[model samples]
Target: MELSVTAVILTLTAILCLYYWNNRGRRSRLPPGPPALPLIGNSLHIDKRAPDRSLIQLGRKYGPVFTIWLGPRPAVVLCGYKAVKEALVDQADDFGARGTIPSISKVTNGYGIASSNGPRSRQLRSFAITALGHRGNGTSTLEGFVQQEAETLVEAFTKTQELPFDPTFRLTCATANIMCAVVFGCRFDHTDPKLLALLHMMDENMKVISSPWGQLYDLLPNLLDCLPGPHNRLFENANKIKSFLREMIQLHKDTHREGTPRDFIESFLAKMDEEKGNPRSEFNDENLLLSTFNIFLAGTDTTGSTMRWGLLIFLKYPEVQEKIQSEIDREIGMDRTPCMGDREKMPYTNAAIHEIQRYANIIPLNLPHTVTRDTEFRGFLIPKGMLVIPLLSSVLYDPSCWETPKSFNINHFLDERGQLKHKDAFLPFSIGNRMCIGEKVAEMQLFIFLTTLLQKFTFRSPVEPSAIDISPLSSGFSTLHHPYQLYCIPRRPARRPASE
Candidate 1:
């Protein structure tokens, strides 16, 4: 019995020594990072509760590119424009794949473009771009869609009798309609239960994904899945969205055509049929369903949040708002509704819109991309499957890139002659091949809705400047603040016809 006990103790001692030796020297090879504790690593130092600020603090100490331990996983953070550009742009395809967090995998199921890599990712991305007609210079296909949605939005808002109103629910509805129009080839009224559930799911999923608890759950999903938490709630929400997408797919499948496609749903369904027999086809019902729902979540919130931010800024900076209003009046005139084409004529207004995107910086750290192959960036070794985050907020707010990154300066986008100048650093939509797929659609909506709203209503603060706290609260992966309401007061044009 003593012999057996001695053997067991020896084996335990040997295993512990091996584990210690394994982790001891591994830290030096990786990039500079914070001190870590046992089992948790640097997670103890990190405010996993507020990863963004925690990361920003770490970036200051460790330079732009640094490593942090997400439990046992090694996560490399790319901060500032230089580091982000190096990894995402200079070494584009090297970091084409997305790193799948345990929580994200549980939520997304490794199905959508946000989670996958390789040929499947490429195929889905290529197909989405083609289907949306987001190609080349001056594409009219997406512009037309934006214009239609803006008109419908105006009609809906007009129903409210020029009274003091909160634009949140309506604005979300209008923005969501455009998303729906793109994905399912339709729009939903704000009161629709199914649509409400989808939006809530999108919001909740984002919240859970960015939380500390969420991070822990992601790191240990196998064990966590058996227990109950916010992650589980997010998963349930994701499933509901999937179910909604399935219903929409069935509807599209029931009524689809070959050459004459009705909308995105019809077009995608047609593709599935055409590629049905192919062994390598990725156009199955499941992919189509997930991709469609992905659009609904991605397209709607980003644009809607942006518009909400734009109005808040307008209320804060009335002079700038007035300048935009004046430009809109001169370019599009008081009688007619503003369209996508009007964007060029109204240069100042366009610049202001662009500035709003830069100032808001909704996506502080963009969707994480995985290093697909071994690559070197700025003399640092980036191994395959490493999570590379491109901090877009760094680019938008880069001191070298912008003259005044902090100030809400429209002039940054305006040249000496006050015409719109597209700055290379102004990449709210992000850069390279794996950029936001619905970028064109988002731009179109921004131009149309921003211009249209300025023409119709002047956003004003309900109380004094001191009463307003413009600081943002955490929304999700995105940097949206508290739910502040705005008053949309109708503006009477300089020239009203006798009919009015």
Candidate 2:
């Protein structure tokens, strides 16, 4: 009897899935795409390991705006700068809501800023901007945090005796340490076991999420959740990381002051206390825990990964490294630390960082967005709550917008005059309302971190430069670098400041 019941349930599931798939694109006036199959929609069309590559291929055939199915759901994918800018920037109000990530949405449960929509997102966003420190108003508390971490990072590399070692671990620690100081008001010692374990979890989480397992889980979450797989490791690590955040939140609860907030956690806790009487406030324990987790996942990984990609590129082309290091030496000299102010004076270094961000596909398909209400975009009807993907790689690598979209060229971010020239399509942190909240902090961190290291050391790969493979090992949710070691030989520039 049990077997019969299970068979009956399975039959019903298949029938419903088939019914939904049969009418996939016909029901909605979403932009046209290739035909979808029964029960699977267009899952087979996507390369599970690297969905962005497949998506880019499809975009060429289907045009900038088109509909594709990820399992039973019909999503509108916006490709290229013009189409993406039209929806995300031109109609920011309709496309500002956050969409779901089924693979881990169960874990987050729509409580945090990254996963939440509407009122909660706005409230959290407003609070975050203020807490991250005032960027241009000269009250940049965040810059001090990043600069301190950058100095420590340089010292750590200097201790390696200029031997060849994988800089991934040290770089991760350096970037994560900045987040720790911003969030918790303290930085961890470079050799701390606690910090090491957290970084390991982060690294593992990235691997799983970028693998086929994570993509499959997102595509067919219902079926995959019942079965055991490598994607399970991602969930496990994410949860453990959340648990760590929870403990930290509890610790802050014991010592947090009301008006004198030291860090983001304290400021948030004080706000929660202020809003305790308000029934509709989004500032609660769960939001705090998940929001901080969102920061850890985002703030730590992107900066660290970009830096790693940078080293790989430099190893591949030592000449590029020479140009940036020369710029650093001439502009800042060896006596003073590099700051956000110096970024303007050193155009080549600034352009180098911009090109690295553009060339390294850090975030491929950016965070999913949703339609706030029934809307029309590029001659198609998009119903409220429909998932919309802004393909970031499409924009960053769009041929129309970039001179050498397929190549690693610093000239893309520079003009013939050798000054840093900003490109309209270069939206690495993304553009419009739902853009990354930590943009200012990240720019400061990357500039200071890169320049500070160059101030004290010159990087060289163990093998000859030409033998190094600059290609990424994997590209799914984001690009991942393979294991490579390098020498951070100490250096001091004797040249005088160029414009001083």
Candidate 3:
């Protein structure tokens, strides 16, 4: 009995020694972060509730660039403009990898541009840039396509009539329609069964990322895999979306027109055929499906959320909205829908849009990247596969970069001559090789749609506007508005005519 107890004690001592040794070295080398308990390093510090604010506070105590662990995994966060720019741009080659979280890994299967690494990432990036076109704002064809989508959006909004109506669903319809046109060369009405299913899946996916269950899943990925929760439901929904993508891929293959690609899927399908026999070819049906999936989720949700916020911003700042409407009236006139080209002529309106992007500062830290190889950041040794987080919100709201970082100021993007000024810190779309692919399209959509809507309607805050929470809700993956409604009143086009 004595010998058995001694053996048990020895085994426990060895395990304790191993744990301390591994964790002690990590603690000393990395920047200061919230204290971790035993095996769950900083998991409590990074719980789902208000992660962005928690991270910001942690950033305040630690330097702008510091490391935090998601359970056992070490994640290096780059806060502020300089840190983010330096890491994401200056050290672009070093930090080009994506983390394969259990949820993402299961969903993407180690493919797709947003969640891949190495040669595959490079191939995806290159193919996407090429497909999008390589010149000014990529292709003029894309701009024309975006403009057509904008016209559709304007027409949709116009159909809402003169009564006070909420623009959320309508804006979502328009935004999702743009994605539809871009991807499958089609648009779905707000009631389409397939579109609604996709939307629910998107919501579920994002919800899983921001929930406590999501935190638990990330912290205990292996254990969580066998459990039942919303995370699993989200995964199931993701599979449903993937199945839809496969159906679309098969449809594209069956009905493909030779030498005359009609849409994004067609172009991609043709490219896959061209590179089918090549050894380095990553352009397969799976890649195409994931890419389509990424575009749909990224394109629709982010833009739709921004427009919703845009309406709220206008409701808050009536003067800014009035000025923008004046500029739109002078440029596009009554009865004419604004085009992508109209943005260049409407300086104040353009500046306001830029200001909206800056102030909103959505996607606080962009998608996390991993170090491709062993690298150095200011004499600090960053080992291979270390996670690098680029905090874009810091750049957008950097006091050094803007006169009033927190307030709604349009002059930040405008000079004394009333012309729009570009700031290097204005990286809403991010910078470098891993920069967002659909930025130009997104910008064009925001400008045309917002300007067109403002020209036709005057958005008013409902009675007791302060009751509305302009502050964003923590939606796991992204910062989203609490489901709030706004009153959109149609303005007589004659009252805001160009002659005025």
lDDT for every model? Answer: 0.75, 0.86, 0.76
lDDT of model 3 at position 274 = 89
Best-performing candidate as measured by TM-score:
2
What lDDT would candidate 3 get against the real structure?
Answer: 0.76
Instruction: Report how far off residue 110 is in candidate 2 (Å).
Output: 0.5
Residue-by-residue lDDT tens digits, candidate 1, 1-500: 99999998899778757876886554445677876554466777666545666787788899888887766567788877777776777878787677776766765677766665777788888888887764212354445656666777777677766555667667777788888877776677767898787777776777777665677786677777888777788778877888878888888777775686656778777888888899988877767777777777888888988998888788778898889888887788767867666777888988988999998888777777788876676667766777776777778878888998878898999999999998888888888778888887788788888888888877767666457655557623677655665666678867557894
Candidate 1 off by > 4 Å: 1-28, 48-50, 134-145, 155-165, 495-500
Q: Write the per-residue lDDT of candidate 2 for residues 126-165, one digit (tens) a residue.
A: 8988887564223466677787888888888988998889
TM-score of each: 0.90, 0.93, 0.91
Ranking by lDDT: 2, 3, 1
Give a tens-digit lDDT track for model 3, residues 266-364.
888888888888998888877888988888778888888788888888877788888988887778886776776787898898888888777776677
Candidate 3 has a TM-score of 0.91
As for TM-score, the candidate ahead, 2 or 3, is 2
Clashing residue pairs for model 1: 97-370, 472-481, 473-481
**RMSD per model, one decimal:** 3.8, 3.1, 3.3
